[model samples]
Target chain A: MKNATGIWALLLGLTLAEVALAYPSLAPAVFLLVLLALSVGKSALIIAFFMHLRFASRALTLALFPILIALILLLLGFLPDAQRVMHAA
Target chain B: MTRNETTWEGGGSPFAIGAKPLGMWLFVVSDALTFSTMLMVYTYSRLANPHWPAPFAFSPSIVQATVMTFVLLSSSLTMVWAVDAMKRDDRRKTVQYLSATMFLGIVFIVIHMREWVHLINDEHITLTANPWNQPLFGATFFGLTGLHMAHVTIGVVYLGIVALGTRMGKFKTDHVETSGLYWHFVDLVWMFIFPMVYLMSVKR
Candidate 1:
């Protein structure tokens, strides 16, 4: 696909942005947020374009999305408890 | 084109035999759950000891890990090329690209071995040693990264098998596409691990 090269360029740009965020002056939470955003963006691009999941049937995409959603929910749900435990320790 | 027939035929009906790409996605999802658990543990450990000093202060050898990351990521591109070649029915190009991917995968493993030796021998960050004055740092670092390296080693073996299969004309075009899916998933995991494990704790 002609668009594949452009997607890679976008990935490279995101990586560059991640490197820039490593600067100490950036707020730590903000840096983490930016990194997470870029990571999700890169994953989306790879899944949608390179994997051709974008062109696939809606049922297939729906099947995969639920698993990812559950994983995210699990991660977020445990974060507070983890933080509390860490602070207590 | 027969609209009356419910089944579209290639190697078999897509639903009957199941698409190889779909099967690979199922595997990837299972693998993702494994990595997610590891990452959750990593986060919990880090949270437990936020003030703990990192083991290595400014080791330039860590850059070797970065280089390895780049090599692994580039291999994904080769894998995509291999899949494209297969789609075009260019077996020769497919084999070449697969070989290139296998070679890069081996290079990554070799570099990883060197980095492991440096971490263990030079830095003395063994399982029993607390190099960073934190007990869990060495344990969790090695555990998470070691598990990832194990996955990479498994991927290399799989790629080698696929390379041989391609040479023998055992892999149908769809099979090559499926293998490519797994290869790209491996790359995807490393993309996350590279930043989280290697880059996250880097001192400014």
Candidate 2:
């Protein structure tokens, strides 16, 4: 809980790595995947450390993450259909 | 079990946190879904359009956004410090850290507005139309960033109120911690936004 500055530094470093990764001429899918993984890593650090969720009850974390992840997955499920409709048009 | 142990039937908080912070967590979940949907829509648009515009250049746009990210991350650190100070019952340092957080949030807003102006005026990228002729670019870019900026603006005001209340001996540790939760949520949203919207669209 006390390592706020350390967490902040890690977030900054990840951000810089994100930008550097963008500079490379990687494949689009690869670039997007890396960007997303790094972004998710940054978010996890912030949520766990900065928000003190790591110190919170396991019940709270359990109740929150599952629903959030499920909702995100539900939203993602529509992407293929969206593309299908666009292709038909 | 012992007297220290409580159960759901005993009318105790199963989450072991105050209602205020729990409420903030709920709000964070809802707000996160909103941003996630928007980002998904942006991704769909980007994938659908063959000529999606990558309008951000390295010199100004990316650099400005990186600085903004730094500012926001620094503000989150300040917010954490503020909450820590409040937990220790050092009201003076709590208010000081809160003030520092608010100042950094304002700095973030200023930088963001400047970037928006640069895009609108110099780059001719509006909410609906852009020189790229790929209108979804303008729409999604502005929509996501605009929503995030609005949150930052509101967070600054929210922190200001908390700081003033804490200074006047009105609010307590829970209040400061609750506000910090909101501020940290805002920072995390920007964590996703900076990469998806800005880094992905960086002009190569």
Clashes of 2: 0
Candidate 1 chain B weakest ten by summed lDDT = B8-17
lDDT tens digits by residue: candidate 1, B69-178: 56866787788788888888788889898889888988988887887787788767776565567767677778877877787788778877887787788887778877
TM-score of 2: 0.94
In model 1, the runs with Cα more than 4 Å from the true position are A25-30, B1-17, B56-62
- Estimate the TM-score of every prediction: 0.86, 0.94
Cα lDDT tens digits, model 2, B10-81, are: 567889998999999999999999999999888777656656788889979999999999999999998988
> What C-alpha lDDT do the candidate models reach, one value each?
0.70, 0.88
Model 2, A1-89: lDDT tens digits are 45778888889999999999888777555676788789889999999998889989999999999999999989877766645655665
User: What class would a CAPRI assessor give candidate 2's docking?
Assistant: medium
Judged by DockQ cut-offs, is candidate 1 incorrect, acceptable, medium or high?
A: acceptable
Native contacts retained, all candidates in order: 0.17, 0.72
Q: Using lDDT as the measure, which candidate wins?
A: 2
TM-score of chain A of 1: 0.82
Q: How high is the DockQ of candidate 2? A: 0.63
